[model samples]
Target: MLITGADLAAPALALLDDYEVVFAGKAPSPDDIVALCRRHDPVAIIVRYGKVGAAAMDAAPSLRVISKHGSGTDTIDKAAAAARGIQVVAAAGANAAAVAEHAMALLLACAKSVAVLNERMHAGHWDKATHKSMELEGRTVGLVGLGAIGLRVARMADAMGMRVLAFDPYAKDVPPFVQRVELDAIWRESDVISLHCPLTADNAGLLSAATLAACKPGVIVVNTARGGLIDEPALLAAIRSGQVAGAGLDSFAEEPMTPAHPFHGEPRITLSPHVAGVTADAYVKMGVGAARNALAVLHG
Candidate 1:
């Protein structure tokens, strides 16, 4: 077995005690992965970072399974793996609590201007007389996906006395508090729009300039999902023009964002280093799930 990152959680490592495992170091590039595959010819890969494509698969002819560390498998080339009879699996819902909590935190931060207020206090300025935070008690929150994370978010929002609306065609038997709605309704009536969907070919730019324009003015946007879902340039323009009151983002179209990125100094946009699901507990859960999935395939 080959693990793609620097290390796996100790609990997960314990599960693989009977199997020989190798680490590919931290932040391995595609070429690096291929080189490691050629050297080790691993039977299974527990992917924690970097991508696994046809090149890497071809190098390791014995490769049988590619298990993702977390729910999203967008980084892996599923089509390529399929062609070679290599199975691809994900630790689905392993980080649900962690990610859902992060989404709620982002939504709250954007709604209340928490970051801006903290910065103002540090600068020795007080604008309490002029500042008014938006209250979320009665506002509506629209969720793009109703998966494990989204369902938890909906429950949290509902507890805060907010109306919950979700748009996921595949979701069934959702909580009564969450109303199933169309994307149009999400744009038209939601005061806050949160994305929890996967990044797919058809919905790469789900929230484009046109979609952003259709949203209610002063809408707050929160995305803990893939950044490709929202067009970055269009989002920046919307924020600049005040169409989007504020945004809380945890991911980007490109990972390890460059220092010169446009959102670097933007006050209205709050950014995180794509670590929404990186909590200590979630790490162990994801790691264990990934390890078990790989073992299941290798033993079968």
Candidate 2:
């Protein structure tokens, strides 16, 4: 067994007691993973972070399975793994609560300008007389996915008295409060839009300039899913032009966003370093899930 990151939860580590586990450091480039694969010839890989591609797959003739630490498997090359007869699996829903709560926090922050207010207060200024926050009640929120995390977010929005509209062609058993609708309805009618879908070839840049333009003016955008789903430049421009009133983002097109990134000084944007699912409880759950999944394939 080989782990892609420096650490895995101790409980998960216990599951691989019979195998020698190798760590690829905190941040590994593609070459690092390929080198480690060639050297260790690990039979299974638990991906905590970084991409797993064809080069790494070819390096490890003994590799049997690639398990994801979280729900999203976009970082792994599924086609390459399948071609080589290597199985791919994800710890789906392990981080649902953690990520759902973070999405809600981002939405609330954007709607209420929470970060802006905090900065203003710390700078010895109060805008109580001039500031007004958008009320969520009775407003429509459009969700792009209805998986575990999306379902939790829908329930949260419903509890707040917000009308929830969702677009997920494959979703079933949707709650009564959520109205299943087409993607066009989501764009045309929502006061707020939240994304909880995986990044796929078909939906990459789903929220492009044209799609952003179709949204209701002053709409709030929240994304806790893959960053590639939205065009970064288009989102930046939308915020600037007020096509998007505010944005709360937990992921980005690039990880470890550069200090000089365009969003750095943008006041209307709330940013988190894609750690929405990194809570202590979630870390353990995801790690355990990944370990179990890898073991299942290997033992079978």
Candidate 3:
């Protein structure tokens, strides 16, 4: 089996002792990935999502399965893989709890204005009076999607004395502490809103400027899910104008945000480099699951 991205090599090597492994030096382009796959002609290909494309599938006619190192498959061309009779498997649920913890961390940071206040203290400015923070206790937290991560966030928020309101069309029932509401109710009533939905065509740019206009003023927003779910430009405008009090973002529309990014200058925003689910524990679980899935396909 071949691993196409360097980030996955360490984890793959640790968990996949039974397999003969080959590593690509870096994330290869479509053509390079195809050429490499063709040269190896391995029965199973273990790839990091967003690095492999249709060309890789086209290049390896003998490839039976593609094992994803993570959950998201946006980087992979599912249609092409299906057309080629290739099975695609991901380490689903392996990183859910870790990601849920990160989401809650963001929410707490935003509610407390932790980043901005810390910077003020470092600059020798006594801004405690100006940085009056909101308490999570007795506040309403709205969860946009009640999936694995959302459910976990809801339970945590409830335990912290916050009322949990969740909006998930597919979720018929959640914990008794969580009250399922409509999307508009969440927007109108929530003191803090955390997004936990996947990026799909139907929900892309779900949190746009227009949606921000409808939300309660001084609302804290947290998104550890996907970048495309919230419109970046709209979020910037909201933060600047104080329509949104603060935002904690773990992912952005672009990875490794450029130096000129507007959010970099915003004091009301806390940013992380998409490392929410990239924890050591999450990595091991995902790697082991991917290895098991690969072994299953190889033996079958």
Candidate 4:
């Protein structure tokens, strides 16, 4: 059997229909995943939203492959899959443009207070127009990562006439337009800071309280990466204290944030339902890539 931990685009699932495909159903909790896998004994598991760990892997002796719907493998217990000889594949760079564009959308939204102004305009208020909005040109943008998505963001930032500073120990052959800099300079000088790195044990809370404290006053932050990169409680405290002026967050420490979540009521935060990489074009690419990976493992 083939199984999908979360819903995939119809096209991708259609490719696997030659086999007995099963759905893990909606918003499955961790326990639900183990039960679903054990019940189905899926040979191939495509994990989009659910966590696949040692328990789920151990449940299925026939499990042959595990495919991540996107680039990150932090959600999957990779070591466990390897121990059981299950091939793991990811659709890297499939959504780089979509994610980079979403990061820019968040940056522009925060800089201009576009959402706030639109709401005010609808309320028949024009007082906000008298106040100055933040400008993008000539300001400095510090990037925390320089991978495919981050590189794309760098190009866009340069096109906007902004000086780009970056911190990526793994990156080389630095572009002339992007000045590779240290972390200290990023926090000390940049007006805008964005994160585009993957989540790992070494840097889980890289943007913790101490890091935030070092940022320039009223610094705007945009996170298009994993939610675990920042400590949500500490971030909320900083926002409440007004040290971090505004945030554009596409991911969160927790998914499916409740309506009454504190971030929802904060005016300085702009939220999206983690759709940064879910544009129609990227969605199709990811779906097809994941489907093809599963088929290769199953047939080979």
The TM-score ranking, best first, is: 2, 1, 4, 3
Q: If both were scored by lDDT, which would come out higher, candidate 2 or candidate 3?
A: 2
lDDT of 4 by residue, 152-208 (tens): 999999999999999999998778999999999999999999999899999899888
TM-score of each: 0.99, 0.99, 0.92, 0.93
Better of 2 and 3 by TM-score: 2
- Measured on C-alpha atoms, candidate 3 has an lDDT of 0.83
Positional deviation of 192 in candidate 2, in angstroms?
Answer: 0.7
Off by over 4 Å in 2: none
Q: Point out where model 4 deviates above 4 Å.
A: none
Tens-place lDDT digits, model 3, residues 196-241: 8877879989999988999999999999988999999998899889
Candidate 2 yields a Cα-based lDDT of 0.96
| Candidate closest to the true structure, highest lDDT | 2
What TM-score does model 3 achieve against the real structure?
0.92
Q: Which residue pairs in candidate 3 have backbone atoms (N, alpha carbon, C) closer than 3 angstroms, thus clashing?
A: 50-75
Q: Of the pair 2 and 4, which is ahead by TM-score?
A: 2
lDDT of 2 by residue, 22-88 (tens): 9999998889999999999999999988899999999999999999999999989999999999999
